[model samples]
Target: MNKSAHWIIYVAMLLAVLTVTVIVSLSVGEISIPFKDIFDIMADKESMEYGILAYIRIPRTLLGFAIGGSLSLAGAILQGIYRNPLVEPYTLGISGGASLGVTFAIVTGLHLLNIMFLPLAGFVGSFTTIFLVYTLSLRKGVLSVNRMLLTGVMISFIASSMMMFLMSITAVENIHGIVFWTMGSLNESNTTMIVSMIAIALISLVISYLFATPLNALRLGENKARHLGINSNITIRILFIITSLLTGVCIAVAGIIGFVGLVIPHITRLWVGSDYRILLITSFLSGSVFLIFCDIVARTIISPNELPIGVITGLIGGIAFIILLSGSRKNSRII
Candidate 1:
């Protein structure tokens, strides 16, 4: 098939899979409703069982889809920016910082965080990490990937330590909520978080998509990219902004969900090659699929008890990442 035909088929298949998965996700829980009744409830034609479906299950399923897609796409962008196979949206300590911010909000009796303020704290935390990393990495107007990576690692350790301190000081009753945030749950789905996350994801995707040419130029090395009329400084700065926005927004909504960003792009690159155009788009879809599937397992594994979505993702992602690393190492040795 031509590339167009392939894209059409892929998109159609993804939509179908997502549709079925969403329905299945909605139908599951303490009460099992038949697929037909679930459809009817969605159609607004109504049955006595529609109440719980409408009020409860739908929001959760939708949030799963949104957060899954957003985090995956964010990971794809990070992979491109760092030119690293393992980097994810949270690789820059944005998520750790956001976690700290959320923990702060929770402990401070900030009612807004439980609702709207949590995302704001996440944004603050995310940008602060970005700012610190940039400040530390920029010396004599030069930015090095190694410097950025080291800074992020250091910041993550510090932020995580702060999170632990807050957890220790927190009251036993509220510790559960803060601890849950650290573990990463998609449980706090609401219309507000959904809207905010979607907006950030879409904006970041659009901006990053526009950077395909520049990113490709970047792959040619800093000096070579600059020779081609690509401003390395400008491109890196834009990339930093985009990554911060994506990581911040995701942490705001989902609270430090891991591995999807780190693993998704490397897998996508295996099929889509090095072209950012195809890489970013496919990464978004595949990342969404992978995350939603993981979420499904999280909700179903213990039935009547939801596992933290982050735990399941981390387990699977960690294994997959190891395999990829092994393969990449073999490839490097061959070259």
Candidate 2:
């Protein structure tokens, strides 16, 4: 088979897996609905099953799909821009800023007045981080990826410290709220927010594909890419903003879910090679599958007591990355 055929097959298999995962996620919850009844239950609007399927499971699954794919896509783009395997979406402090925002809202009791305030605050915080990083990294009209990375790390640390300080002075219940949110949850039932996330994820996915060639050229280093007539500066700046906004959206909507951004792209790259054409889609699909599966485990693992989705992702993503990294050590490629 030609390379095109192989890529098609890989993508098809990923879609198949994602289909199965979505089915399982919608069916496997506190009240396990049989696979066959899923559609039927969702159709019968008057039934209790309808309420659960329509209001809770479907929306949650959709949000998970969006956030998961967005995070992974952001990670892939960031790694390409920075040419670093260890770089992830959260490495830019988007999550930290969002977490700090949410913590502030919680402690100040602003979230008590409205349901949208938390997410709004989170988005604002992450946008601030993005602005700061972009502004600070600007060196005589050039975007310094090195300075951006370091500045982001420092900002992330500072944000974490501030969040901790807030947690310290807050009431016990407020502390609980902050801690739970930081651990991440898919309990968001807002259909509008869920739909927005899905739209942004798909739009970002398509937009990222437009820059695939530039990303591949970037693998040859910025100066070399410029020599090859690829405007690495413009390309990097655009992608950085796009991916940062996407990451901010994901973090704002879903709280601070880790590992999807960090691990999924790396895993998919190893599976599909470094070509951005296939790597981008595979990382998205893999991330969606992994997160929906983790959500299933988070909800069903304890049966009546759901663990945080972030916890499951951290544990599973960390272990999977470790195993892959160790095996890759035989070849001495950390990525």
Candidate 3:
């Protein structure tokens, strides 16, 4: 088959998987609602099942899909920009910035005034970090990708250190809140926030396609890309901001869920090759599937008591990546 035909087939398969994931995410929870009953329950809003499905699972599912897709998309973009497989969204210090903000909010008890303060704090912190990293990386009217990566790492460490200092000074109860937020959860209920997250995720996906050719050009290295009439710096900068903002929204919306950004894109690349045109959408869809599945496992594994989503992603993503890498190495294939 032609490459385009194969790409379409792959996308169709991923879409089918995403559909299944959404249905399964909505169906699995404290009480199992059969697939057949979900639509009926949606229509019967007065039913208790309707309330559970509508209020709890629907928002959570949507957020999972958005955050998961966005993070993975961000990771893919970052990896392409840096020409590094290990570069994930958090490598840019976005997560650390968001975590620091959450820690601060918990420490100051501002989160108690309103839960919205938590996400607000996280977004502000990430944006501040983005600005700081970008400003520091600028030299003679250029955004240095290498400098930005190093600066981001340094800033991430500083943010973590500051967060630790705050934790050291805060109450034990506050510490628990900070710890839980860092571990991550999708327990948010604000419909507006969930809708916003979904919108941002989709919009970012659309925006990413505009950079697909540039990203593919970048795979040949910046000097070569520039030789081919592609403006490497502008593309990288634009993508960096988009991915950073998208990641910030994910972190702000749903605490620090790890591995979605790192593992999802890596795994998708292994299966689909490094073409950003295919990689972007596949990673987004697979990420949605992976996270939503992990979330389902998270809330149901212990039944009545839930494990944090981060824990599941960490355990699963880390092990899976390691195994895949090992097998690929043995086969003389590279990711």
Candidate 4:
């Protein structure tokens, strides 16, 4: 199929999946609201059902969608910039670093500072990791992809050790909360969190989308992109800022939902090729759909007792990654 035709199919599939997932999520929550009730609530918007639907499910579900989509979009930018298939949200240790911030806040009883402190600390950690990786990878003023990957791995290991130290110092009673947060949860979706995440995500997505052409030029390597009138440094700077912001905000709100960022972009690339224009749009929509569905499964699989959303996402994402890799290898041999 032509690129346009393939893109149309992928988008249509995403929309269909999104619609089904949203309905299933609303209907299958702990309260057992019926499917018809969900539709009626949505349609009428003034009834009692509407109040329950709007008040409870809508905000949380929307937050899940936003969190998933934002992380995936950030992943696309990261992968594009580094030209690496294995890079992911955890590569920069952002989520682990964020978890450490939260742990420190809890251990020290810094609840007042909790509002923005955790996220700020998370950003500091991630930027530190990024800079260290960049510095380590630079040799004679050029960044080596292998060095960057190695640096990220080493930094994550170090950050994770710091996180363990924080956890060990905390009291036993507070351990559960810290552990739960690290495992990841979407239980804290509120009006404030939703609004903040939406604003940040929308702005980042717009900026990333607008820079799609330059990103495409970037894929051709620094010298080639420079020859084509693209300033590689400026592009890298912009992408780092935007992707870091997206990653920071997401880890701040959702704790540490892993693998969606890594998983969704690769899937989108497979179905839509390397064009960031279509890849970006499709990744956002499809990532949201995937997360909501995973959440619904998380709630229903044990009923009354809910599993962590991160657990479900990681499990599904790991399996999906293997499948995609196997198929990619097969395709490569065929070509």
Off by over 4 Å in 2: 330-334
Question: Cα RMSDs of all predictions?
Answer: 2.6, 1.2, 1.4, 3.0
lDDT of 1 by residue, 1-335 (tens): 78777767766777788888877777777788878776666667456567667666776666666677777777766666677766776777878888888888888868443577766777788878888888899988878788998889889999989988988988886688787877777766466767666676667778778898988887777788899999988897788777777777777777778988877777767765677766666777777777777877888899878899899999999898777667766433411
- 3 versus 4: better TM-score goes to: 3
**What's the best-to-worst order under TM-score?**
2, 3, 1, 4
- Model 3 residue 70 CA deviation (Å) reads 0.4
RMSD of 2: 1.2
- Each model's lDDT comes to 0.76, 0.90, 0.90, 0.77
Best candidate (score: lDDT): 3
Task: Pick the winner on lDDT between candidates 2 and 3.
Answer: 3
Candidate 3 accuracy as TM-score:
0.96
For model 4, what is the alpha-carbon lDDT of residue 297?
A: 84
Q: Give the count of colliding residue pairs in each prediction.
A: 2, 0, 0, 0
Per-model TM-score, in order, reads: 0.90, 0.97, 0.96, 0.88
Expressed as tens digits, the lDDT of each residue in 1-335 for candidate 2 is 89999999999999999999999988888888888997787678899988989888998888888888889999999999999988887888888888999999999999999979998889899999999989999999999988999999999999999998998888998998888988998889887888889999999999999999999999999999999999999999999999989988887888889989889999888778899999999989888888888999999999899999999999999998788777746323746
Candidate 1 shows a clash count of 2
Estimate, for each residue in 105-126, the C-alpha lDDT of model 4 and write its tens digit. Answer: 7677664555566555555656
Highest TM-score model number: 2
Off by over 4 Å in 4: 39-52, 112-145, 331-335
